[model samples]
Target: MAVGQVGGLLPHVAVPSTMPAFLIPEWGLSYGEAGLMASAYAIGYMLAAPVLTTLTDRIDARRILIFGSLLNALGTVGFGLLAEGMVSAMLLWGLTGLGFAGAYMPGLKALTDRLAPGDSSRSVTVYTGAFSFGVGLSFLACQLIADAFGWRWAFILTGLPPLIMTFVAWSLTPVTPAPRAGPLLDLAPALRNRTALGYSFAYGCHCFELYGVRTWLVAFWGFVAASGGAPLGAVVVSALFTALAMPASILGNELALKLGRHRAITLVMLLSAAVALAIGFTAGLSPWLTLMLMLVYAFTVPGDSGALTSGMAAAADPRFRGASMAVHSTVGFAFTAAGGWVIGVALDMAGGVSQPGAWALAYSVMAMGAALGPVFLWWSRRSGASS
Candidate 1:
C-alpha cells in the first residue's frame, strides 16, 4: 500500500523542487507563467477529486491504482516531451493531477478496507510515511538527473518508477466493492458543518504556506547563494532540506499520535512560522546558518499535514470518507494554486532577482498563513468541546 501510494506521489515531489528552477529558464517562461503551470496542476486536482472519489465507490481500488499510475506516467512524460508554451504545460500537468487524485486517496481506502484488525493507525502512519519518502526521493532523484543529464531527463527517468509500481500494485492488491447503503454525499451538509469547515480552512492555510515555500525555496536559496558570492549549490541545499523533511514528517505523525493532533499541529505551525519569519533577517549570516534555518523551516512546515488528514478522517462518517477526502483535497490544492500565483506576482513586482527582500516578503506572507491554521483548528475544537 505504501509503495503504491508513494509511486503516485513521486511526480508531485519532483516537480515542485526542481521544475521551477530548471524549467523556467529552459523553457523561457516568465515567473507568472511558471506559477500558472503549477496552479494548473492543482486545478486539475480540484476537478478530479470529487469525480474520482465517486468512481472509487463503484470500482476496485487496485484497478483504479493501475489506471491512475499509467495516466501519471504518460502525463509526466508528455509534459517533458510536448510542453512548449504555458498552455501546453498546464494541460499536461492538469492530466498529471487528475491521475494523482485517482492514485492517492483511493490507495488509502484500499489499505484501510483490508486492514487485519487493530492496525488502523499504524497502517495510516506507514502509508503517510511512504508518501513523504517518495517525495524526498523524487526530489533527490530529479536534482541528480537534472544536474548530470538535463531537465527533461528528470521527468523521463521519474516516470519509470510509477510504471513499475503500477504493475506491482495490480498483482499484489485485491479488488474492493462499493458499500450497499449510506447517505449520498451532499456538499451542502459538509459545507455547513462548522467542524468540517474549520478543518478545511486550516488545511487551506497550511497548503498556502507549504506549497508556496516548496515551489520557491530553491530559487530563494539560489538568490542567497549568488548574493553571498557562495558556490552555486542551491539545488543541493534545497534537496537536503527536502530530505530532512521526510523524516520530520514521519516523526510528526508519531508526535501527533502521542501529543494529540491539535496540539502537535499547533506547535509545528508556530515553529515553522517563526523560522520563516527569521530567515530574511539572518540571510547576511554565514551560509551554514541560513541553510540550518531553511532546514528547520522545511522540517516543521509540513509536519502537520498527516495530522490534519487524520483529524478529517476521524471526524468523517465512514460512508462518506471518499467524499470527505475529495473535499479536503480540492480545498487544499486550490489554496496551493493561489499561493503559487501569489509568490510569482510578488517576485515579478519586485523586479528580477535583484531583490532578495521580495522573496523574504513572499515567505513572510506564507508564514502568516501557517500561523493562522492553528487558530482555526483551536476554534473548531472549542466549538466541539462546548457542544
Candidate 2:
C-alpha cells in the first residue's frame, strides 16, 4: 500500500517542480500568478477533502481510493495534453489536487482500519513518511522528464504512475468502517475532539510552512544559482529536500515517542523556524553553505509531520475516524493554499523575487507559521485536550 501510495504521488509536484523554468516564462506569469497556480491544487484539496474523506465512515475506503487514483491520472494527463496558460493550468492542477484529496487520507484510513489497535500509531507514522518519500520522487522524476522531453511530457509520463494505485485498491480486502451517528458532513465531532484538534491544528501550521517553501523552493534555488551560490540544479536540491524529510519524519516520530509528543513537536517546530529564518538571511553565502542550510531546513521543516499525524490518529474516536481525518486534512490543506499564495504575495510586495530581501520576507512568512505551531499545541492543551 505504501509503495502504491508513492506511485499515486508521482505527479503530485510535477508542476511546482518545473513551473519556475517552464510555466512562468511560457505564460508570462508573475511570481504571484505562479504561486496561485500552485495554491489552486491545495484549494481543490481543501474543498473536496471534507466530503471525500468523511465518506469513508460508511463506504469502503478502497472504493474512494480507486476513484481518486483514476481521477489523479486523468487530471495529470489532461494537464499535459490540454493546459495552455494560467487558468487552464490552475484548473487542471486543482483537479489533480481534488483527486489527491480522495486518495491520501482515505488510503491511510483504509490501511489503519485493517491494522490492530497497537500498531496504528507506528504504521500511520511510517505511511506519512512514505508520503514524503513519494513527494521527493515526484520532484526528481518530474524534473528529469521535463528536462529531457519538455514540461508537457513530464506531466504526461508522471501521470501514468497513479494508475498503479487503482490495482492496489482493488486487491485490498473490503472492510466496512464503523457506523456513523450524524450527518456525513457534520464536522462537529472532529471539532470537539480537542486532542485530535491540537494535532490537526499543528499539522495545519506545519503544512503552511512546508507547502509555502515547497511551492517556491525551485524558484528560490534558481535565485541561489543565478546569484552565484549553489550551482546545483533545481531538480537535485528539490528532490533532496523532500527525500531528506522521509527519514526526518520517521525519526521525529521516534523522538516524539521517547520525549513525549508535545515536547518533541514543540522543539522541532522551534528548530525549523530558526533554520528557516537562517536560510532567509544567510543562504546567499557560499554555494556549499547554501546547499547545506537548505538540506537542514528540509530536515527540520517536516520533522513534525509524522508525529502530528500519528498523534491525531491515536487520539481520534474510532467511530468518527473519517470525520476526524477530514477535519485534519481540511485544516492542513486550507493553510496549505494560504501558505503558497501568501509567500508569493510576500515576494511581490517585498520588491519581487530578485531582491534578497524579498526572499527573506518569504522565509519569514514560513518561519512565523512554524513558530505558531507550538502555540496551537499549548492552546489545545489548555482547552483540556488529552490523548
Each candidate structure's TM-score, on Cα atoms with residue i matched to residue i, is 0.90, 0.98
In candidate 1, the residue pairs with backbone N, CA or C atoms under 3 Å apart (3 or more residues apart, or in different chains) clash, namely: none
Candidate that scores best on TM-score: 2
lDDT of each: 0.73, 0.91
Give the TM-score comparing model 2 with the true structure, all chains together: 0.98
Instruction: Mark the 10 consecutive residues where model 2 has the least summed lDDT.
Output: 282-291
lDDT of 1 by residue, 228-248 (tens): 755447667666666665567
Candidate 2, residue 73: lDDT: 93
Clashes of 2: 0
lDDT of 2 by residue, 121-181 (tens): 7898888998989999999999899989999999999999999989999999999875667
Prediction 2 global C-alpha lDDT:
0.91
